[model samples]
Target: MHDMQKELSTDELMGRFLNQLKDEDQLTEKQKRIMEAAVKLFSEKGFHAASTSEIAKEAGVAEGTIFRHFKTKKDILISLVAPIMLRFASPLLLKDVRKLMGSDLPLDDLLKQLYQNRLQIIEKNWSQIRLIIQEMQFHEELRGAVVENLFGVGRKLAEAFVSSKIQSGEIRNFPPLTVTRALVSMMVGYVFFKFVIFPDEGMNLDDEQEIEIMVDIILNGIRNKE
Candidate 1:
């Protein structure tokens, strides 16, 4: 267990980061390929629509190889999506969350930077995000796995951040939980509207403009004050 001093590319760094979750399941190299193929196929073709043979073809493995590793297709789905969900639980992302919680940047500037960072991350990982949302609607196990493994730290961090802002009088005087929920609601709404609801190729705001406008609305309001 020694640390290396060499620099790693983003993909290599992510691969090493994910390998940390190998503590839970000892997957062979082939098993890892099968899980990745399963995720891609599941995202493209729905879980029920994708067959083991198709997964095998995508994974470049023999038909029986998938079955050898996974008892059933659902087993493969669980294995594939669980780790991807745990990407949220990564300490690397937690470091950013901690910074967000503790940073003394101006509230508007902090929020804009946070939203831009999140937008980039979500854009990069939209495939996995889509798979998680689609499957978790029906697969309680996948949903439960995310809550059990990831939400604890995230919820606490969010609560602490909100509480601190409230105490500092930077935020309006509202219940901490309510304020936290409002922040998440505003963020989710911004992302959905920008990316999905009202996405117009010709009339899109640049990331900085989009994030700043949204952060302004979140910090101030649309209502006219007397």
Candidate 2:
């Protein structure tokens, strides 16, 4: 087949697998509506809580229409997961992050910029993030995808960053992998604390202030003084 035809076919397959595709990708109108509705309902009510009838109602389609496009509600959930993961895996964001990693900035400064960029992304996709976290335990496939797409892709870069800091005596001489995990844990813990445990409106510190404090705490533990 021609390259154009192959590309079109792949786009069609991608459309079937994800609700939020690029503006130019083509999903049939009903499929588009179904996907959009499913995503909203899933994000709001969750996979177990939201029903197919409700999705159909939200999409203004017959309940059977959803079945016509998908084998099960879990199928829709699976489809939604790909797009949510894609937001983080996007080429532009990866390029920007790669640039940051390669820059001459100090470790703390680099981390602050990285955190800010990631926080912006997390905030924008909080709904989907919540959905994935809530459901990942029950869905092995989803968990695997998250591990592979999210963590697997970034592991080498993280290790390299940690190693560089260690060699320069900027951070403690822990194993590169250990340092990377610790840093990630710190950020992840902070995100949960800020967003889940005690959401910002209740917090005393503003976002920038919170970021500063978190960075300070991280540096205090990891900075090498010897």
Candidate number achieving the greatest lDDT relative to the actual structure: 2
Candidate 2 lDDT over 149-221, as tens digits, reads 6777678778988898888899888899988887788778878887888885525547777777778888885
Candidate 1 per-residue C-alpha lDDT over 1-226 given as tens digits, one digit per residue, 9 for 90 to 100: 0112343443443344354445335778889788778879888888878888888998999988887777677656555555565656767756886787578898888877777777777777766677777776765655565565566666777788888888899998888888777777877777677666777851466778767877888888878787
TM-score of each: 0.76, 0.78
lDDT on C-alpha atoms for all candidate structures: 0.71, 0.75
Q: Runs in model 1 with CA error above 4 Å? A: 1-33, 68-71, 194-205, 224-226
Q: How far does residue 214 in candidate 1 sit from its true spot (Å)?
A: 0.6
State candidate 1's TM-score.
0.76
